[model samples]
Target: MKPHRHSLYRTFANAAAGVVHAFKTERNMKIHAAAALMVFIAAALLQLDLIRWLFLLLAVGLVFTAELINTAIEAVVDLVSPQVHPYARIAKDTAAGAVLVAAIVAVGIGIGVFYEPIRGWIGSLL
Candidate 1:
């Protein structure tokens, strides 16, 4: 079979469609998106420096990337094994585990980035 090719615009559009689909269908995706929004709002309110912003952005990006990958893996596993199968269960579980790990790492980065600023803000209130 000849390899199908897509224009760059079409490629990005397709990717965007996948993101929309995930956001619409997956509860976890919505939760992650909400968390990201809150993080961005906090970053703005705190007036994070460039380095801190970069760290938060990277952490958030890592989480969304992991979630997207997990969504894709779950879809493929479901497609291949519509029936319950041991390997399919393992694949889905492992992908979920990866998402959990990414979220935990992001939380750690968030605390590290915001701790000093928040502490100072609280201190000033006293």
Candidate 2:
């Protein structure tokens, strides 16, 4: 029998598994994914330029990173406390707050990037 391979590929595979787990188990992640898909489709339909696309990608990355970190923090807090505790609550709340901040920033970026184009499209419909 052949032994298992250990390489950078394995590391990335494990990382992808974590992302899949998050998407499967987290409701917010699913929402984020749907929003991302919508943004990409809208961008394509609107013929958004490269710079705007880059900003949108950065916003998505920021939101996903914050969400994953928040999940990690919550898991660690739960593992350490396992019961109701003020510090655990504080830690979890802070992590969730970070996700909220990231999400808000992403919304700002999306509005900045898409608002004018969408507004123009709506005006053209009249």
Best by TM-score: 1
Per-model TM-score on C-alpha atoms: 0.97, 0.90
Best by lDDT: 1
Residue 66, candidate 1: how far off, in angstroms?
0.6
What does candidate 1's lDDT look like per residue over 40-112, in tens digits? 9999999999999999999989988999999999999999999999999999999999999999999999999
Candidate 2 lDDT, 1-126, residue by residue in tens:
998778998889999998998899889999999999999999999999999999999999999999999888888998999999999999999999998999999999999999999999999999
Which regions of candidate 1 are displaced past 4 Å? none
Candidate 2 residue runs with Cα over 4 Å from true position: 1-6
Q: What lDDT does the true structure give each of the candidates?
A: 0.96, 0.94
How badly does each model clash, as a count of residue pairs? 0, 0
Weakest 10 consecutive residues, lDDT, candidate 1?
Answer: 59-68
